[model samples]
Target: MSKIIALSGTKNGVISIRKINEPYGPGSGTVASVGISLSGESENPEWKVHIPLDNLDEVIKALSELK
Candidate 1:
């Protein structure tokens, strides 16, 4: 699954979320990827982070707590 969102305060910026399978090659497993692109190019993000599926829940909880 994947999603794209317009970034606040920027005309052409965007944020993208996706599930990547074996992003680091075979055996790397799947990951939840979050990316940001100030240039509006979701395929080539200026910043990105990959969260392991095993840690997703905890990560979400932590992020929520910050809100």
Candidate 2:
């Protein structure tokens, strides 16, 4: 008799991108990356996206492409 094994694909996670106010206050001229937890699993995945605080348009474009 032969045994069959199941195959599965695992995902490391996804990088979540979102808008946020200026870190210092509410101005602009800065770029930052932060890790966001996506899954509700015990080991919350760590993800981040590079966004220009000055130009949100670029961020929007990148997000659109992702979709």
Candidate 3:
């Protein structure tokens, strides 16, 4: 599954969030993949980070504290 976030002040810019399995290959487990693209290319973003599923909650909490 995936979700997209449009960015303001930039044409076609977006952030994508997706769930990926074995992104690093078999036995790598799953991750919450977050990507940013200034060209609206969710499949090939300019920047990305993969957060292990187990760390999702703490990551969310930390991000929330930044808000």
Candidate 4:
């Protein structure tokens, strides 16, 4: 099983952020960064941003500007 951490929305509450931790083999893999977008229609598909674990800081900065 993988681990995920959710991020809060800004503004009134539109989008959310999620951090994915995927384990593969004996520490031979890495974790991924993903974003769950909820700003579209109720039936709209969620967007996934595949980012390397090393760019976690970038994700945080991007999420901070969301509303």
For model 4, the superposed segments whose C-alpha errors exceed 4 Å read: 1-29, 33-47
Relative to the true structure, candidate 2 reaches a TM of 0.31
* Residue range 22-59, candidate 4, lDDT tens digits: 54446543555344545532123266555667877787
Which residues of candidate 2, in runs, are more than 4 Å off? 1-12, 29-50, 56-67
Candidate 3 C-alpha lDDT tens digits along 1-67? 9999997889999999999999999999799999999999988999999999999999999999999
Give the number of colliding residue pairs in candidate 4.
0
**Model 2 C-alpha lDDT per residue in residues 1-67, reported as the tens digit of each score:** 1111221343443333334456456775455444444442312335455456656678768879998
Query: Where's the lowest-lDDT run of ten residues in candidate 4?
Result: 10-19
Would you list the C-alpha lDDT of every candidate in the order shown? 0.98, 0.46, 0.96, 0.48
lDDT of 3 at 2: 98
The residue-by-residue lDDT of candidate 1 on 1-67, one tens digit each, is: 9999999999999999999999999999799999999999999999999999999999999999999
- Of the candidates shown, which would achieve the greatest TM-score relative to the real structure? 1
Count backbone clashes in candidate 2.
Answer: 0
Better of 2 and 4 by lDDT: 4
Residue pair clashes in candidate 3: none
Off by over 4 Å in 3: none
